[model samples]
Target chain A: MRIVALAGGIGGARFLRGLLAVTPSSEITVIGNTGDDISLYGLRVCPDLDTVMYTLGGGINEEQGWGRQKESYVVKEELAAYGVEPQWFGLGDRDFATHIVRTQMIDAGYPLSAVTEALCARWEPGVRLIPMSDDRTETHVVISDEQGRRAVHFQEWWVRLRASVPAEQIILVGADEAKPAPGVLQAIADADVVILPPSNPVVSIGTILQIKGIREALEAKTVVGVSPIVGGAPVRGMADACLTAIGVDTTAQAVLELYGSPLMDGWLVAEEDAGTALDGVLVEARPLIMHDVESAGAIAQAALDLATEIAARRGTAPQGEDAR
Target chain B: MRIVALAGGIGGARFLRGLLAVTPSSEITVIGNTGDDISLYGLRVCPDLDTVMYTLGGGINEEQGWGRQKESYVVKEELAAYGVEPQWFGLGDRDFATHIVRTQMIDAGYPLSAVTEALCARWEPGVRLIPMSDDRTETHVVISDEQGRRAVHFQEWWVRLRASVPAEQIILVGADEAKPAPGVLQAIADADVVILPPSNPVVSIGTILQIKGIREALEAKTVVGVSPIVGGAPVRGMADACLTAIGVDTTAQAVLELYGSPLMDGWLVAEEDAGTALDGVLVEARPLIMHDVESAGAIAQAALDLATEIAARRGTAPQGEDAR
Candidate 1:
């Protein structure tokens, strides 16, 4: 079946890999979150897009669940030696090539979506990957510290500070002006099911939803979301801190409620949160921990099954417009 | 005595190191060639200036006479993997950082000279190093190949082709509009002597002279040049191909005559070329090979001594305007 998935970085990428395993690669379309995109050393770096690309492309560091495998930090080390600032972010030599190619393309006037398409030509990540918006939309976190209250780039808040500083607010700098990247709405409108992989609710899936027409388009579809939080904790990464930044509880129920019935038709929670319910949404609880491809695929299959069930219950068909 | 030197890449950098060994770095000012600079993968790569910087800063790949020591090519390999064009150039991972920082600064509106100074802050390359022009002046070579007669970047000709293809002509694209960098003219006017290292005469020192005011400034100073060509051939590199492209003979006598009396007060040549002569210009023959630091230092001393001798014969003092 044709599917559309919203993704963030590691967790989202991991979940998408499982989705790819359970479904035909050609049927999948990923709307990657560009809110965390950053310009480092004049090169545009999209963490979420690269994570998904590398993960699916089989170049990811399996141990860290992010970045390239067999990576070297020669470039980063040399930059430090030259006394260039923002030395905290870990950019490996192999990883730098992606940003270099991406930045070069963007500077040459191609949109981010086109650049992503070109990069995917090399990775051949199997599925179609497109950024949420081609327009600049960097996520910034407001925090008060010894330097007083100031807003810093999301990467600085997350990678540099390691989310140590409590984020008072999480802001999408250019969300209002950003149009959903070309094909984003059409993908959502044409999908048999829209899957929200176990990505961060606040910054990953939530950020993609913030784009003008995306949420409105997904709201009319059979959208199934697999909760990132299991047993009141994130499956991976510091999703808890991100949720706290937006005043959301670190629980599957609260997150589902935040998504609500209009945008979500099915919610997949862990067995620990079995009683989680929504007024008009179907909730299913099962083993959500993705230890390997098999477990993750099972979860993906369950989400798709729920999406199919929800569509059947509403007397609607789970198929794209062309298929219908 | 305050000294000013015109330089290019490998040969010039080696000569500068030798010059540094004999004279205090604080007494020297180097006008580096920027005509061979090229933008690779959207990052500005100043081969000549970097060569001088790395050589003097002790970060140079000693055996290769360029790039960083203990360099890795992970970035280059990855760039090739992504199918980025112009992969023929050898830019190491460590070298990539330098370009990244440089490109970032250039994009941020800093002049090339200022950026070089900032880069030097870390290298602390002893002597004051300045580009010949703050303005861009890339050298392009016209060659007739299967692609027909077309102008390719000087780097493509030198590094990629190894100058195997005959260049019909070598053009400094922006030289006519290029002005001497801020301190270039002042350095020339304030010099006790101006030494031309055994850099590529047709490209390096010659390109620097092509900048609007630099040649005029040096014409009024005590200038002594070490002939890059010795005994009918270049001491090293493809200087002969560059010379031939300009319809000049690759010989000590020919190169000195190309510079003429107004530009050259003295010319140093190899022992084999004992009969090398130019009217109104003193020609001296010696061992011009820079086998090591000590030998290179000896050559630098000989050039300085010749400049002093030329000034003495002219009944003028070998000192700057202020000293006089």
Candidate 2:
């Protein structure tokens, strides 16, 4: 089946790996969130994109679920020694090469999509990967602390602050101006099913949806979402902090409602959230944790099966045997 | 003494270390060559300035006579893995940090002089280090081979090709439009004596002289130079190839003539070239091999003494007991 997956960082990447195990990687097109992208030490760093690339390409630090395996912080330490700022974000020696190549290409006038393609040439990450948008769209967070009320880059709030301070608001700064990257709309249009992995509802998947035409394109497809919230908390990362910022309850039910029936045709939540319901959407309860590739693959299979059931119920199923 | 020195990489940096040991580092201001500077992987890499900084700041790999001590090549390997070009240039992980910081500063519209000063703050190289020009100036060498007669970056010819091919011509691109960096001319004007270490005359010291008004300013002061050639060969590095490219012989006498009487008041040659002489310039022969700091210090002391003798004979010695 032609599959399209919307991804964030570690959580989404891990889910995609599981998706690949259960499905042909050649059929997958991953639309990665770029709202978390930031310019650090003058190098363009797409943390989410790189995480997906590294994780799928077999270069990820497996224990950490992000960054390159056998990564060295020599460059980071040296940068700090030179007293360059944003010391909280860890960029390893191997990882810096990606940003360097990317920044060079972007400065040379290539779009972000083209640069991502060039980087993927080295990783050969199985599935076709495209960013949410070609234009710059940074996520910024508004908060109040000892420094008083201020807005900081999403990375400054997330990676550096560890989402400790309550975010008053989370904003995608340039989403209104950003167009979906070249293949984004086409991928959704061609896909038999669109999968939203267990990624942050407010930032990762939500940020991509904010991009012009992306949400509209996905809405026309049979979409199934795997809940990031399991047992009333994020399976990984600080998604709860992001959810709280948007005044959304930290539960699978709240996130499913946030995505709504207009976009999601099917929703898969943890067994504990079996009571969660949304009109015009097929809701299924299962074990939502991605403990390993096998477990994650089972979750992906369930999401795909739900998508099939939803497509059949709507009488919009493609004639292909796989889709039917 | 308010001393000024024109420097390249390796030889110049090492000599400055000895000069610092002999005299107060605060008294020395170094005008480093920017000809070897190149933008690699979108980062500004200044070999000469960094050499001077690393050598003096105790961060240099003493054995290699360039780059950082205990450097790792993880970044370079990763870049090569990405199929990035110019893999021949070995930039280590530790060294990459310096370039990244410099590139970022330059992108933010800081001049090379300002960036150099900022980098030096971390190295604390003791002597004030400044590039020969704030404006970009790259040394290009014309050579004939499979690529035909085309000008390649001096680094490409030197580092990648190892200067195995004969250079037909050497050009300093942007020299005509370049001006001496801030404090370069003023440093020469305020100097008691200007020292030319055993740096490459063709690319290093010669490239700096191409900057407008620099040579003229130095000509008005008491100037001394240490010959890079001893026993008709360069003390270190590939200075002979560079000298030949400019149609100058690889000998102490030839380099002395290249600098000429207009710029040189005192020229220190090795004991092997004792008879090397020129009218209107004091030429002193000494044991010029810088095997260690002490030996290099002795050579520096000789150059200073020659400057003092020239100043006394010209009846223009500064009114101080040291000058007399």
Candidate 3:
């Protein structure tokens, strides 16, 4: 079936790898979150996009779930020697080439969407990967420490600080003005089902929804979301910290309520959170640990099965087998 | 003695290492040629400035005469994988950091001179390293191949083509509007003796002279030049190809004549070209091969001695000892 998946970094990328394993490559379109994109040392680094690309293209470091396989840190060490700042964000030698090509293209006046497509040409990431928006949309987190309150870039908050400080607020700085990247709205319109992979609800899928028209498009479609919050904690990443920033409890039902029934047609919670109920959405409990590719594939299959069931209850023809 | 030296890339950097061996670190100011500077993958690569810095800072690959020692090519290999052009120019992993820092500073609105100074802060190359100009000044060589006569970037001709195709003309593209970088003119004016190292006379020292006021400043000073040419051939590099393009014979006397009596106060030729003469300029013969640091130092000493003799003949007090 034609599917559109919204993704963030490692967690999201890993989920997509599972989704790709079970689904036909030609049917998947990934809308990668660029809110965490940062210009490091004058090169545009789209961590989420690169993670998805590398993971699917067989270049990802499987153990780390991010960066290139067989990566070298010679470039990082040299930058440190020069006393360049932001030393915490490690960009490997092989990974640096991706940013260099991307930055060079962007500097030559191509928009982020075009640059993303150009970069994907090399990896052939299997699925069509489009950024959430062509425009700059940075997710900044407001944190208060002993020093005082300040807003830092999402990467700084995530990678540098490790989300240690409690986030007072999560702001999508340019989301209000962002237009969905070319092919994003069309992909949503054409898809049989839209999947929200186990990416960050606050910064990844949530940020993609913040872009104008994306949420409205999903509201008109059959959407199934896998709970990034497996039980009372995140399946991966600092999603608990993020959910807390938005004043949401760290539970599958609480997250489903946050997305709301109007947007989510089906919600897949983990077996641990079994019997959790949502008012209008179809809630199913499934194994969501995603310990391996096979487990991830099963999770993806469960979400698709739930979407098919939802379609049948509404007396609409399911596009699953026929579309495939 | 207080000395100001004009330099190019490998050969010039090697000569400076020798000059530094014989001279006090605090007394030398190096005006490095920036005409060979190129922006690759959006990062500024200053070949001449980097060679000088790396050589003096103990980071240079002695065997190659350029780039960092024990460098990795992971970045370059990755760039090629992405199908980025200009693959022949090798920028090592360690060297990429310098460009990254420089490009970052430039993008943040710092002038090239300021960026150069900031980069030098990390290297502590000892001598004050100043680029010939803060403005963009590229050397382009006019060559005719099967594709017909066209001017290409100096690097394309020198590196990719290996200077095999005869250059009909050599043009310093932006030199007419270029101003000498901060401290270049002041260094020349405040010097005891200005030395021209055994750098490429055409592209290296010649490009610096093409800057608006540098040649005039040197004309008013006690200038001494060591011949890059020895026994009717360049000691290193493709200086002969460059000289032939400009219609100058690859001989010490011809090169001295090209600089002319008005600009050059003293000239040092190799023992093989001992009888080579230039009217109105003091000519001295010496063993000019810079096989090692010790030999380079001896050559530097000979240039200073020639400057002393020229000062004594003109009944002017030499600034060498007093400035030292």
Candidate 4:
């Protein structure tokens, strides 16, 4: 089946790794969330896209789950030496090259979509990895600081503040005017199963949905979303912070309800959130923590199985697709 | 005492190391030429500045005069994966970070001079290294190619073509309208002596002179120049090709004459070309080959001593003041 997975960083990359192992990579298209993308030292850095790319390309340091392994921090040191702003996110000497190339290409008139494609050609992530849009859609977190209430860049709120402050607003700036990247909507429409990994529901998955027509495309398909919340807490990262900002409690039920039955035909939660169920949606609980490649594969297989079973029950048959 | 020394690449870097060893660094200011500067993957790359910086900051590759040692090519490999243009100039992964920071800073409203200062903060090349100007002054060479009478970037002409095709004309684009970088005129005007390194006479030091007021400043000072031409050939690089392009013989006398007595108080050549003096310029020919650190230091000391003697002859006078 043609599998299209929408993803974020860390959790998203780990889950995608399992998804790739579970099926043939050729059949996959990962529409990576770029809302957290930032321009540092003039270079475009898509943390989520890089996470996915590095994870699949075998360049990832399993321990770090972020930058390249054995990474040198010469660039960051030089940047610091220059007294640059936002000295939180560490761009290493080796990693800086990727951002540099991406930034240079973007400056040379290539949009993020084209640049991502160009970057992915080297990693050959097996699955086609694309940004949700070429538009400059940045996720800014509004926090009350001593100065006043203001929105900081996603990274500033993330790395600098460590997301300690209550998120006054989780704004996906530029999404109102943004269009989904080419083939994004089409992939969602043609997907036998549209899977949302346990990525941050607000800033990650939510950011993708904010892109025009993506939610509608998923709504039209046998969409399945894996809950980021397990046992009333995110498996990793600050997912709950965004959840609370949107007036949703950090619960499996609350998150699923936010996605709603209209957008999801199947909702999979961790086995620990056992009592949860949806009236019209197929609910299957499994051990959803992507602790390792095999565990992630099992979770991915379960999501695919849920979609397959739902498609079979509806008396609808999905086309055979690549597993990548 | 005032000291001026010529330089190019690792040899120049080595020589500069010796110059720093022998002289007070606070008074030193480098007038680096941008003729060898190239745009690799859309990011501006200045080789001379990097050489000077890396050497001074103790980051220079002891083996390779150019580029960092233990560098990775993942970035270049990845760039090729995107089918990026300008594959001739080598930009290693570590080397790339330098360019990226510069490009980013420059794009973010920092002038080239300011960007150089920012970069120098990291490398801390003892001397204040100033570019000819902040303007995009590119060196292009007119040559007979496949189509005949075409102009190519200085890099392509120097590196890729290897200057095989005879150059018909050499022009510094934007030189006419370009002003000297900040502190450049002041450094030159206030200097007791200015030395042109044994760099390419036409491209390296020659390009620096092309900037407005640089030649005038040099003419107004006790200026000294070292010839790249040695033993009827260039000391290093394709200086002979550059010389042929400009219709000059590859000889120390020719290069000294090319610079002319109007701008020269002293001229230093390799021992093979020693004792060849001009009408009004003091000449010294010494062993200029930088075999090792010791020899390089010796060469630097020789250049400095020459400038000191010239300064003494000029009565250690300040500019705009009567020696009487």
Off by over 4 Å in 1: A320-324, B319-324
Model 1: DockQ vs. true structure: 0.90
Q: Quick one: best lDDT, which candidate? A: 2
Query: Per-prediction TM-score, please?
Result: 0.97, 0.98, 0.98, 0.88
The count of residue-pair clashes in candidate 1 stands at: 0
CAPRI-wise, candidate 3 is high
lDDT of 2: 0.92
lDDT of each: 0.91, 0.92, 0.90, 0.81
* Candidate 3 Cα misplacement greater than 4 A, ranges: A320-324, B320-324
Writing each residue's lDDT as its tens digit, candidate 4 over B242-302 gives 8888888899999998888788877888889976778988889888787776776676667
Give the per-residue lDDT of model 2 (tens digit) for B185-255: 99999999999999999999999999999999999998899999999999999999999988999999999
2 against 4, candidate with superior DockQ = 2
Model 2: per-residue Cα lDDT over A33-78, one tens digit each: 9999999999999999999999999999999988999999999999
Single out the weakest 10-residue window by summed lDDT for candidate 2 chain A. A315-324
Q: Write the per-residue lDDT of candidate 1 for residues A1-324, one digit (tens) a residue.
A: 689999999988888888888776338999999999998889999999999999999999999988999999999988998888889989999999999999999999999999999999998887899999999998999999999999999999998899999999999999999999999999988888999999999989889999999999998888999999899999888889989988889999989988987999899999999999998889999999999878888899899889878888898767643222
Q: What RMSD does each model have against the real structure? A: 2.2, 1.3, 1.3, 3.7
lDDT of 3 by residue, A45-138 (tens): 9999999999888899999989999999999999998899889999999999999999999999999989988888989988999999999989
